[model samples]
Target: MSAADPTRSHGPGGVHPIARLPEEWEAYFEANGERAFRGAQVFRWIHQRGELDPAKMSDLSKAWRVRLSEEGLAPPFELVEVFRSRDGTRKLLLELVDGGRVECVLIPMSKESDEDDESPATSGSSAEPPTDRRRKMTLCISTQLGCAMGCVFCASGQAGLVRGLGAAEIAAQVLEARRHLDDGEVLSNLVYMGMGEPLHHYDETARSIRLLSHGEGAGFGLRRITVSTVGLVPGIRRLGEDFGGKVGLALSLHAPSDDVRQKIIPMNSRFGVRDLVQSLREYPLPRRRRITIEYTLISGVNDQPAHARALANLLRPLSVKINLIPMNVIDASSLAAPSDEGVERFRDLLVQAGYSCFLRRRRGDDVAAACGQLALAERLVRPSASS
Candidate 1:
């Protein structure tokens, strides 16, 4: 099926059983003449064990299991493809109930390094003690099938917005992605940087977070999940207020000033740099955690040393670290990727200015690992979101 298919959502309009909380499920069981504890059992079976087939839930009674199966305890989406890169990155293409498709990526992180050493692919996970050595992977998931924030450099938004995924579809990505984990390699972090502007659909995005982080559910840590945005100020503030700023926030600040930002990030005209920085300052980011600033360096655009200085000056007041991403230049975009030497110079200036900065190494390039890259050809061939 095509990646984009307009369909009714299971959000405010409807609620999918996969998106239900334990209490909500408890009520559902009681309403259906079943025991209340069955709700928790069903939830554990789905979220904790990643078992969608009720018949496989060994603890549940035979009748209850049969009833649950009849009620359609099935996966919200099917895992259609798994493309693995040489560097251990896996991109999962998922087809939703209404024939809509999205992608999620699992990227293994570099082992812990010294403070002065270069860092790993931006693992959204927080820092642990250096003594701990474990293989960690971060899954980059999509909140929409296609994006609304048409950033100039992003492959995801190249095709424009299709539709925001429902909370069930959003939450299900993790449950499904977990099933593909390799032995001894842990799924430790999540970054919402795959195919959409997460904040554009704030309600469903927030609901998915709550659903994933609930102890009785997937129990994914809020701090480990980074929500990347293109500066939707109200949604950013609401995220801080709603989650008490526990959720990691990463801003796609590709340009230092409004003039440059407005030229590249179409949404920058709505939320200017000053206002976005002010919102970050107001955020209640936990003690030791810093807001991540994502800077995509495009040649002759935002990669000059002067631009770096301006970026440092603008973000100086806020507690933040910079992730320098060399632009993934595509044929469709007029922008060109910054030279390796130029990228290092930009990072040098940021480091000289006393900001913790790291170059975000591109993983899974062979597999078109970057967001929506795998779909780029297909999207171009069929621009229509028709299924």
Candidate 2:
């Protein structure tokens, strides 16, 4: 089956109803004896405005609205539950029509003003503060129900793979996440860093990108989206080719060497660290845009100064920025994150080596919404047992 096939039903020639591009929608309308403009209208309603209810679309004729409603143009999943962190992060648990559940998270960016108190506004004159202090939010979306990557530190991979999500199911995460945004805030960025390794489900991930970046649809620019992978070489190369590297690519390189990497990320045995680095070198990244290197720092494992220096040496030639995530401790593994001092020293080594490295702050930990922490908390099993 073509990757473009929609999740549930297919019309003549296997065209998916909800996953159609504007051109595809145009063809569908043409086949149904309707004018081509209807395609663009429907696309705008769904993508631009986030309106899925046919009756709520005011411009379309009642007959067309009824037909569209009957065709199942609504969201593919129902919101099962939402867990909100004290820090304003919200983790959404959505249940697909087929009963498969996936989780997505809404993360608000830290305010720039909070970093320093030297701002003119802090001088306490009679000037009114800017009303637009609302922080931009980034949505972390999942591409599969459970993951097959089996990263030893991750909760999602503990249960093994259930199934990959469809394009509609993947894209609906953003729509669902948007509903939880606070007033004056906008969904500014998207990261496929939730529950699953995106590259494992390449086709659906690609299609979801198309739907999200379509001008008439979600209208998100390609640059604003980041797809995270656990060093799947073929998928990395394919994504670079398919999108010309316009979409942001983040590699989860937890360990510097193959031995350590394979211990944590099982996929590394097949595609080694050297091969992954070579692939990164060849990725068609646009000028001035750097691929993000996500290195999860585990206690006494990959968080030592020597490991940090090795990682720096490995990525020395690539145009990349490193995000040092002190591993989010999960029930499935005994693996623990490094101490704050250890994490800081690791970052210092990378920075001293002339690499741009930032220690990623742990977000939404109170609600189990941090990285590698999205799976059902109650069902988590030991990594040794799961493997």
Global lDDT of each model?
Answer: 0.79, 0.78
> Scored by Cα lDDT, where does model 1 land?
0.79
Clashes of each: 0, 1
Q: Ten residues in a row with the worst lDDT in model 2?
A: 116-125
**TM-score list, all predictions:** 0.89, 0.89
Across residues 1-387, which tens digit of lDDT does each residue of candidate 2 receive? 222323533444454556777898898889889999999998888776777788999998999888877777778878877899998899987776666667899887655312311111111112333535545677899887778889888888776777777777788788777778776666777889887788988887898899888877777788888899998999999999999989889999999999889889889889999999999999999898888899998998888888988898899889988888888887779998789999888889889999877777878888888654645763422222211
Looking at model 1, residue 114 earns an lDDT score of 27
- Candidate 2, residue 356: the lDDT equals 73
Can you give the lDDT of residue 329 in candidate 1? 71
Model 2 TM-score on a 0 to 1 scale: 0.89
Q: Model 1: clashing residue pairs?
A: none
Q: Candidate 1, TM-score vs. the true structure?
A: 0.89
